[model samples]
Target: MKVEGIAAIVTGGASGLGLATAQALAGAGAKVALVDLNEQGAKAAAEPLGGIGIGCDVSDAASAEAAVARAAEAHGPARILINCAGVATPGRIVGKNGPLDLSVYSRVIAINLIGTFNMMRLVAAAAQSLDPLDGGERGVIVSTASVAAYEGQVGQAAYASSKAGIVGLTLPAAREFAPVGIRVCAIAPGIFETPMLLGLPQDVQDSLGRSVPFPSRLGKPEEYADLVMSIIRNPMLNGETIRLDGAIRMQPR
Candidate 1:
């Protein structure tokens, strides 16, 4: 996990938290692979990082497999896999217009929940085959959830459920991978100044930031990357979902 000369794969690496993580990993001398649905965006993001950019749909098993394969071909078997590919679709099971669209709910789950799992399993399989590094650590896998998983506000049924599934998955995955010297951890972030949150009105974004207890501001993508670096360094921190929420428990909206 020193990162120097190691291979890493960062999903959703074209933008936001994943992009920041990719930058951090590359800066730390890791051979990085940037995977995203937006091939052009991935290319742009990977160019300066000196990492390979791979077009991938995390929800598709074949796509995930191929992406992992290509990354291995380019950078050797990856020992660090970060799962940041997710979609945030806000919807209520029962809305003002009655029941919500079933398709919307399904799509959110497919992209956010299943997509994380698809990439994790595929990447972990590849990592498992690699020989252990220092401290018998073969690899580390970091995934992204959301504070919504714990304190979902109104109209966050689909999004919250998908994130909660990710939170639930961490411990089991870590436990399962323990024998292989692989670690699985997740970060449940609060409101951050990513494209998703920034899309809201400025006032809305300001209010959301103020909701955080101490910082009273939104998180930066680089801050998320810093915690990821810590997780990579500290081998004891496994099977846990650390909240990067700055002490915010969302209120019912």
Candidate 2:
């Protein structure tokens, strides 16, 4: 689907990858809606980008539906939905401290996997009501996964499983939405210079960057945004998970 003159919703748009993507879409002429848990931050982020900021918890069904409806009211039936809202909780299923806390795992899955699906279902429903755009495409949805989905290191059981669920969701979602001219795809990112990674100590961050095969540095948020823009532009791409890693296959840490 074309980005120009279309309405778009970006979950987790307050900061990090989602913020970058919202800016990209707005730059490409899409009317963007920024959704995040941080309402003030979302508003601040969207102010200069010429987009609306909405407070949303993608894990909650009611909150997500209301948000999408609010976006539709402002921008008229979004044709682009980007799922960048997620959380990463590092924990072992069975650690040296005996069994890991089950709540930690549940929360991770709820925010990362279920949240992605929650937004997808709502956006796809909204897209289904709209007529197709060029190439019989009504909309395109791009979700964020992680390289951990493929090679989860130690203390990454929760995080990895959540991302792996996102990977697993792509194809079937694409198949279901095909008739409605909506495409589903995912991007499994490697270590990127987002707030999440920045929260780590400098040495830890450096070691993480060095793990990449090439470019030997953290990925820029704009780089991830670029791939998302490309995915929206190309109609032929669907039902697949693209790795945005810099040829990085993480080792078991």
Candidate 3:
């Protein structure tokens, strides 16, 4: 569907992948809404883009509902929903300190997995009521996953499981939304230069970059944004999780 003049909602829009996507969508003439926990940051990011920002906790039902409603009020029903809000707190199921806290696992799942679904469901519900666009498409949803979903390392039990749930949700959602002209897809990024990765030592970051087979560098946020645009433009791409990794199959660390 054409992005120009349509409303788009991006979760985690304060920073990282979500911020990059909000900028891209705004550049394409879409009315962008940045939904994030950092209200100030979201407003700051959305200002130059000429869009609105809302503070939202995606894991909470009421917060997410209110956020989506606020975006619709300002920009109309969202035609594009990008699920980029996630956390990567790594810990083993049974760590040196003994079993990990149950809340820790629940937190990861709540924010990463449940949060994606919360935003998707609410956005799609609104999008379906709108008239179809070019190819009988009412809306499109792009969710974020990780290569860890496939090959999780030692300490990434919770993170991997959360991402795996996203991967799992893509197809069923697409199939269900098909009749409504709403598409669902996902991206499993390998190692990107997100704030979390950048916080590591320089040498460690470089090592991670060198692990990619061909590009031999970390994935750029713009590159991911580019793929999102491609998915939005291509009508046949649905119910699939494309890997944005540069041919990197993560080892079992």
Write model 2 residue lDDT over 175-225, tens digit each, in one string.
999998999999999999999899999999998888888899899999999
Ranking by lDDT: 3, 2, 1
The clash numbers for all candidates, in the given order, read 0, 0, 0
Listed in order, each prediction's TM-score against the native is 0.98, 0.98, 0.99
Question: Which parts of model 3 have CA positions greater than 4 angstroms off?
Answer: none
For model 1, the superposed segments whose C-alpha errors exceed 4 Å read none
- How do the residues 98-164 of candidate 3 rate in per-residue lDDT, one tens digit apiece? 9999999999999999999999999999999999887799999999999999999999999999999
- lDDT of predicted model 1: 0.93
The clash tally of candidate 1 reads 0
Residue 43, candidate 1: alpha-carbon lDDT:
84
Best by lDDT: 3
Against the true structure, what is every candidate's RMSD? 0.9, 1.0, 0.6
- What local distance difference test score does each model get? 0.93, 0.94, 0.95
Cand. 3 Cα-lDDT = 0.95
